[model samples]
Target: MITTTSLKNNRTFIILFFFLLSFIGNAQIGIGTVTPNASAVLDITSTTQGMLAPRMTTAQRTAIASPADGLIVYDTDLKALYYYSSGSTSWVVVSSGINPRLNFKRIRSTDNLATVLATELAAGGGAKYVLNSNTLYEINGTVTFNFPIDLNNAYVHGLDSNDDIILRTSGNIFEGATGGSIRSLTIRAATGSVFNLNGAATQNLIFRDCIVANSASVGTISGFGLVFLSIINFSGNTNGITYNNISQLLLSNMGWFNNNAGTYEKLTGTFTLVEKQGGFSQVDGTAIGFDVSTSGLTITGDAVLESVVFTGTNTAGYVKGYTTGSYTGYNFNNSWNVRAAGIPTETDANAVGDFSMDYTVGSGLAVSFTNNLNPSNTVKVGSGTPLTTYSNLFRFSTDAANRLRYQGKKKRIFQIGGSISFQVPGAGTYIIYIAKNGTVISQYKIYGRGQILNDIVVLPLNATTELVNNDYIEVFAQRYTGANGDIVVPNMTITIK
Candidate 1:
């Protein structure tokens, strides 16, 4: 009953239905190729042509409405790949390599540093920040930043009573923290250290022209890495510095100011090289000094410093055979370099606590006596009240002008060997006592007639002599006959060289 037109239409509908069925059964669409993956709804494969992502500037990308997670885009301005993050409701960089020119969120105060830092680091990118003020900013707790960020003129300080301001508990200030400087800031630690820098590996960490004053009883700076400190003033910490597992230490114009401890700093860890240069300090005579002890350390130049007194116990395990450097305005009481043995070796012979003897053939020699029994200056000798005290012997002049006094508070060695001539009015026994600093040490009894007796001589000083600084020798004469005697000191000299 159907016509030719109806038969033609039915055939067309059957062909179209078969085509739709074939499309739904495969469920694959391919471009530039006829075959596609069985599971893929749409696939594009090409060797010459690449897939083009949605490319736009940052502002244009941010203008996207309701961007789902996993939305990919290429930032023309950053020249990096970015994807939308649903948790943050923003676009984040796909890679961790940070470009220095990337704009960073400004942290004007410490109140917002944590929030801004967390956002930047979670974006998987680097940041650059600037601190506006040089005031004390209290950190609520430990702050751990993982990106390589630049701190340009960032001055973060803490109160003298706070535990810490910018603290890192476990990791470093930032991962890949290189080529960044912490300059021109004064940081103080109240209960803890200013920069813990502990339990982390910091590379190329620089403290340029910074001041760290830590009042904590433990340490000021403690860390392990390649550290460079230029023009840094560190003070007041119990232990000035404690570094472990160091690779290289570079110091330039650094001052370890007014700090006191048994050991100023301890480098018990390992290091390959240490280079220190251009530093000066003024130390307190009593409150400030340092004793350095390292496991194995090799110094390049002399560790000569001003106002810092080094002791023999310091520098115990350092290497030897280096040229001795000079310290200005301060005396080094300890050996600069340490030898294999523990004995301290002198660098200069004329240095402190050294004894030397010199001889010269010259005129202008003189002798001085304390109590010369002459007509003009007479000293009577008897068992009386006033004249019973000991009198010092004549001093011999060694130099041409006798300007250098080796006895009486001056540092020198002494060998008391001299004779004193005496005349007795009647035959009696004259007792001459040798005394050092008003204390009787030895005596000699001389039997004399009415003539002049020149047998009164002092014995040689032995090793048992406890000669203190500025001690003078004296001799006391007494007559047993209860009569006055004339004590004449003839030509005799006590060698004090």
Candidate 2:
């Protein structure tokens, strides 16, 4: 029923449909435009439309079988984009948003710490990032940060203690914050790098098991509760750590503030409580350790120092406390060796029980013996009477019966010098000498002749003697060759230099 012309038209229509299908398979495909971009496989140019990615919950995303490494998805639970990191074998968040799964951000040497901190701040949406108290940011290698980051309450910890985690910075690395700690890290910088801890007076900060080295200065610490424990190798700095307006500071198990260029000043401005314990050593340096002579150094409450050793050839002397402001209470233990200028006069009870060696200049006593009774007495030849009624005793104490006693721990050579005023009963030669523990020291005896009776004769006494602890010193006079009568001692001044 059909002609040969109709059969040819049907065959031509089928050939044209097959050719267009092959052309569509071999060429680029474009939507909403005639020509697609050369770089793209399927280019969809649009002004009022957007492409949609696969969206799923966290459990659904994790259930994908053998997902590709570069697979991107929008997380409904996290409300952010996440990319599958094959190297880490986890899905890392790609947006600057808070990831509850990530407790801490691990930083390596190759990672830019500044950028990571910036991301954290962006996630926090504040001027300073408030770090999680339970989080510990582990630093593994030498991380360099060019700018400073304010971490409000952060704990930056290192994996090793052998300077493996080095934080090298150009300027002040940590800005002021409160109630956090940095531990087991090596903080390094160039010369004149000021590492400041200028938090508020009510805040607290701590550093433990860390090394701050390579010419880094611990600048202007002004926190209230600051603690440093087991910090060693802190040297080569331009100046020691300065303090201002601190309340409670504890430095324990510290080693080697050695070879520093400047003095470490004491706490200044409202320092209420300070305690240094557990073996603090400062060796091989010309710098002064714990210099209290700095202007405005004040201790308003209490300071306890124990087991602090200082060994150096510093001319300024280690652990100096001179002309300081008011300190309410100080309890220095037996191991405190302070080379100070103005030390308080310890009482007799305290000095006998707790007296340590003080290497001070002109270290000795000056006492005066006055004859308050002034009684007329007779003395036979080759006999003496002990001078009594002591006054103005410095570094020397008196027994219950009034005898001068030395209260030092070590034996030292003391140059004894004084003048004794006495009245001989008659014209004769009198012998006055120093007596130790009621025994006359023969070499210290001085001979004087009184020309008339009832007249005063002043005799100069000078000698050098070695004294130990509890050695009581006294002045005695004997009638060598005179009328066997009394020689009244009116006044005697003695100085042991």
TM-score of 1: 0.33
Candidate 1 stretches with Cα past 4 Å from truth are 1-100, 103-105, 120-180, 198-202, 217-225, 235-238, 259-264, 285-288, 294-497
Stretches of candidate 2 exceeding 4 Å from the true structure: 1-102, 121-134, 192-194, 283-285, 324-497
Candidate 2's TM-score = 0.49
lDDT of 2 by residue, 158-270 (tens): 87766455554466666655556778887776644545667776577777887777655666677656555455557666666777777787777666566665665455666
Per-residue CA lDDT of model 1 for 417-461, tens digit only, reads: 434444344344444444555554543323333433333322232
- In order, the Cα lDDT scores of the candidates are 0.43, 0.60
| TM-score of each model, paired residue for residue | 0.33, 0.49
